[model samples]
Target: MHTRTRVVAFQPPVCRIVWAPRFAVKSASNKNSRRASQHEVKAATLTNLSSDRTERRSFVDCASEDTLHHPSQLPDDRQILQGCESVRAPLNVAVLLSGGVDSSFALHLLNRAGHNVQAFYLQIWFQEDFRNYWDSCPWEEDLSYCQQVCKDADVELHVVPLTDEYWDRVVAHSIAEIKAGRTPNPDILCNSRVKFGAFYEYLASHQDHNFDRIASGHYARIIRGDDPDEPVRLALAPDAVKDQTYFLAHLTQPQLSRVMFPLGSLNKAEVRALAKAAGLPNQARRDSQGICFLGKVKFSEFVEQHLGVWPGCIIEEETEEVLGYHQGFWFHTVGQRRGVPLNGGPWYVTQKDVHTNTVYVSRNYYSVDKERNLFTCESVNWITRPPDSASQVLCKVRHGPVLYKCDVSFTNGDQSAVAVRLECNDQGLASGQYAVFYQDEICLGSGVIQTTGVSHAEIGSFVDDQTKAVL
Candidate 1:
């Protein structure tokens, strides 16, 4: 653990004058129309507030006392600052600090922007009853780093414990999906249901604090188009590999209206540099992986603890011969190559039977005949507006930089469900995974996968025939 320290820096009364960190900053040519501006206006007054006292350059003019809007108008969540319609004033932002480098750096940016920034650390770690399942909990250390960052930045910090909410919204949903033989993305649910959903509810109930926007270190951008009638659009980050729009696709318009992403323009390397330059305690800290609420516990251990183990046979799909046994069918998923107890060359888990409690494997998992390029998704959430069938789209079945060009059509003449056909065959098409849709850099939205287009009827009948022959 790194030692945490807080250094009180200078703050201006009317507007904070702080040095803009060395990174890409773009200006908005036409403030009224978002289409005219490719990037958000990020230029700020460059003044080093440290003891050395650097030179000041006024790139972004601060709002004078005469121009300052009334304090009462600052808390309106629906009030968006459009050209000539509203005055430019500092925002009251509630930043979600994860104690990671990206989020800590995002706090730095918000503080420099002269917003009334307050930090909140959500504690979703599994403790108490599930304490034994976790080898080590990192939320304590995360909170410590968050405290140090907020202290140095001279901002108030709040620790929001949402364990029960997390369980009800994300963890339980994940458990249910896994038990029913589907891959569930808890991070996606956490963003929509827990972080933005439950947190907003918590803020609303508490009248003492009123925030105009909820900021996070997410690598996504919000584009408010020229027409105020148009919904806010969630765009991809400059860093494609680190873009998190997929996880945030399910968030409602109201949630997105109040969302701010300061690290949207900064790439991973630029973020790291800014953190190191700001003297953050966790500048050198590695990024956290796996499920957000799991802490140090592996996903397999979580499933085993909740669902327990039911011993089942792992049979070869090509042959009805049983090759090995598995602890449970829920533990394995489609296209998983590792953790299977098999020795005859490499084997991939192709299917699982929940009722029979059987796992199916195949040596040639990528055969052309078995390729999956078609699927249907239900519960579709369109971020901006629903696109017509002729619209060009790209789809992501899972997280990462990989995206497949796809075609989409509304099922049964309505938008109740969507059928997606990928241009290329995918090997890991699993039910219950989210199919996030995008058009160019703009994230359209996402949906719950209802069908994987993989059938096991032939295999099931063949296994029964072999069993009868043996008997």
Candidate 2:
């Protein structure tokens, strides 16, 4: 790790200044120098220059005072100020603390780095009417844990209520997608619409504090582009298994520029170790699973509470055979094997007929007519620059640890919609689920799956033949 010392000092109610070591710099005569000098003082200042009562802070990096000795050798405050005259100040960073081990550890790391860190917990779950069904919602417990962690770190904690926004943007959209027979990842939408979107705006609009950037516990990285005009790109975390770039693929360039992920480089084990070392209260707490706002309640139960239940027929795709009956097709997804009440061994869901309220199943999960190597996607969002249409890209259709090599091409001259053909067959490419694109470890962009070349007729004949042969 490069050793750069940071010195922060607040000047009454006006502003606070931070001085740090600069990068390598070129000669004064070089007009197009790219390197910054180590002797140069890089200062970030939080100035209260706005006429309104609110304090506004901007991150400005300019040339400042002469370079001093190493931070470890600094003797007095006077010398520190003298060495950092023309530099910018430290940033006032607000971290979205979820009361989980990841966010808590991220907050600890930021504080240790000597940044002005404040913790904000978004209150996104409210079950006033459906309390009976959602009694297991963990917002209260999570909030308590967040408060404890913030108190231990001696940082101010803000509880920002965003329940309405979360429901309107993330939960509502998720329910609608599932009802339409499409599998939607609510966590992805939550990160884009709630965590980075609404939460960030709330902090920025606050009258008291002017936060420079917002940080989260997501396991992803932001690599700054070399060109000033180029947007920062989102990259995979060092821990491949825990990388969350897929969930954050829909975020725009501006949303990403103001966000930071402190846990990008550390894996789960390392995060646990760091949390233990920092004496966080919830170091041993188990990781949360399923939809975040749903908490411990079953997803089906939650959906039923909102969408209600509709009886549907579970038919065998091969023979049009009614294998079983389901309470609702909306609660099920393609490629799902569990919770399917079928008498003949294990069955996998292959297709859904929303209009007829029917679900098609197959005994062999991989052998289905709906299985295809090609699909189409719409609503594409590129993180930085769009990749060449002819270039081969690695694509992930779901949140699992698999990445498939695929060929991508825009459809009907539409830049935002794409057709992707994989090297091998993949079943259950659910509509509304994002197909994230990548080149090696760098996430290029993603698009919502629109359609796939899955023919139910082809699958029906195969299943019928197999059954006749077995009989």
Candidate 3:
């Protein structure tokens, strides 16, 4: 450990796995959304006070309700720890445990580092009254895993239940966003709604529990700070080999302040070495892949299981011929290839007409690309404030890739910067994803792509926005 940074709390807001450190530190970080619905607008106005300099967004970990033999839920288990409203403490830290390699390692490292540490697991939900993962894991699920880790660390263990309401509000909204042709920011929303909203809100109700910092198993970083005197906003981890900033660009300064990334300074190999040296049983455990806490299931597949769908048609890009049919229009994306019925040619999914199950396809970008280089987004959350009137900054379409030089512009309302044109085009880019701007790897802020325009070649002085903008 590079003498890990001391924990800092933001008053009672210690919610969201994203606000933690696991998926957060990629240890060569490769990588790096959204509008204000009514729910988001409400969150913006809420704030809390702290008991100490280290008050985190305070939250509780409620146990679950289970069947006969497995009485996981303990009724009449209400306890209040106070001024929990904010999470900004310096002496204590919490690591979200999922019983996987990343989180396990994170828990062990933090415990050993001598910080006041505890382990927590948010209970996952079940379908048709069946929870598939409760006992299948090699170690216990996050809940018990946290318990064991806490016992060893001489700390408390917390278990937050993933209630039915969470699926309806968080999961369902995520599906709806993706289906609406928007690159749904589920992990981001999950943090805001469940972790921050329900968990922190409830945790704040307590009058005694006070911890300062929250950590997780994410693989991203915070580069610059909201306040120059403070730590920089999270950045790609130092290892750079397995960065996950792409999935975490939505972190705002409010969340960043109370967050810590202990593994941010280490690589997977180093973590394994530490785990092995510590004789942790799960030292040899393989790192879990895919979205943190979300699991290995494909995004589209999961959405389909919950969302009802209707079949639709596929159309040829140039000829407008009805090539074939598909299961549902929502299942495909602008640059996707699978799920679209084969038509004997090297066909790719080029467009989706949601009103009708009509997909458009073509052999090349010129024929089927409909993205606009210039697009708009709302409810802007920026970590770095651009110099006033300094309109241009290098921006990145996503993580993994470096930022590109561009001219930046915003809408008249300027709710968020509305448009950016790359110095040039990149092939096969699509709309509805995210376009995060960066200044030398430091993420300024990010936005959902509304449209992408391209400029076609060979027609001098006659370039359309679609042809000019790369998608």
Candidate 4:
């Protein structure tokens, strides 16, 4: 049977899932109009999840349709205590600045320490309307945000427009990986390809080859080598709850040497505290979420804007019974249970067939289960080759949790479907996400997820058809 699922995406204000009230959505929509009304609504600020709608009704209510925003649980003070030993500051860094708190805060810390860090912001493909808002970031808003600090610290500020060619390199490749069912982490790719990519080339020539290193505000640590005898490779940041190393699993040694993470030692609270104390203006501003460059546009909004949406079916995993209709499949990720209307304890998305537009749901019973355990991946970019095909490894799927024991291997097991076999299976495994591999918390490498939960027979079937195309 064909696996691609179809979904029905509703228009904003009348969405099937009421993230906010209808009037609220309408008020937000009212602002998107071209005519400058006497009453301009507050700009909506949804990110990868949702944006804020001003002049629009309030979407962030206790009624609870907002699953995109991460829950609030600050890390403890201990988690932020990693700067104990005086560390070597980099000579220079090509930091990715979104003009938001994270990047902005990071630039301050690095520059204050006398490290050479040039900032760059990549503009993801956006509509003319939204694009104008973000333009103010570098030229008007974030430029001021960073300039004040950069001026105080006497550091130079640089901005690079994300050229059409740049998107082809970073964004397009990432979308392809996701469409093929691999969980592509654009943040990691943005750092590696954008900052460390052509941007690095531009900086070298611009600086007359004077700078020495690249730095940013990623909250991750390094473990450095394969064995204990080897040096520490970049591991999880000291702030476990906020450590973004899961996104950085793709960084190889060469990149690591040139990279610097000043916030590796600080937790979210600590960082905020420092921001406040440092007198950085955006410090108290709400933490910006979503795509780094896109500002507050929702992922669903952005994707629908591009690919557009269509009606689709929601089905039960076992019975394949039609449960309800949806606006679009792209709006959701696997393990999601909030929007789908099934009256029970809860149901997690077990599978999504893009072609059929079907979302398969399983009751939210097990934290981890066999159905969730079986996942496949491709676009495998390992920092170095794994020690063995099935070495015990610590793997994390997306930003859900810490590293768990898993057997690491690459197989034509699914053709175009590079595979990862987790030793202990978990429920709610979503396809089209990254499976970051590590050894004892140190990032080993990562791959894009292709398939999740295929039986031995299916694996064999894939091997037999390896020579053929996946679709």
Instruction: Give per-residue CA lDDT, model 3, range 1-471, as digits (tens).
Output: 121211222222221111112112111111110110111101110111112222123121111101112112211101011111112233476666766656666666565455677666766444322225323333344455556556665667777676664787667776777667555656566665665456555456655545566677665554433454674564655333344555555666666666556555444444565566656655665554445433444556566676656777788887998777777777776666556577575576666776666878765543313333444444555665542334335555654323345655554343354556665443335555666665433556677766555332222223234333222
Top candidate, metric lDDT: 1
Record all residue pairs in model 1 with backbone atoms less than 3 Å apart, i.e. clashing.
none
lDDT string, candidate 4, 115-152, tens digits:
66666665444433534556422335655766666666
What is residue 395's positional error in candidate 2, in angstroms? 0.7
Which predicted model would earn the best TM-score?
A: 1
Residue ranges of candidate 1 with Cα displaced over 4 Å: 1-88, 128-135, 226-229, 389-391, 454-471
On a 0 to 1 TM-score scale, where does candidate 2 land against the true structure?
0.75
Better of 1 and 2 by lDDT: 1
lDDT of 2 at 390: 48
lDDT of 2 by residue, 50-72 (tens): 13222323232222111211122
- The C-alpha local distance difference test score for the whole of candidate 1 amounts to 0.69
Q: Under the 3 Å rule for N, CA and C atoms, how many clashes does model 1 have?
A: 0
lDDT of 1 by residue, 1-471 (tens): 212121111221111111122222221122222111111212333332222322333233222212212222111112111111122237788999999988888888777666788899998877636656454767778888999988898999999989899999988988999999999998899999989999999999999879987889888778776875778888876444467888999998988988888777554655665577679889989888676556677778878889999999999999889998999999999888888889986798988889999999998886656647778788998876765445457788876545666766665333646777776566778899999987656788899998876333422232322222110
Preferred candidate (lDDT higher): 1 or 3: 1
**lDDT per model vs. reference:** 0.69, 0.67, 0.50, 0.54
Per-residue lDDT, model 4, residue 385, is: 49
The alpha-carbon deviation from the true structure for residue 273 of candidate 1, after best TM-score superposition, in angstroms, is: 0.7
- Name the better of 1 and 4 by lDDT: 1
Name the lDDT value of residue 199 in candidate 2.
Answer: 84
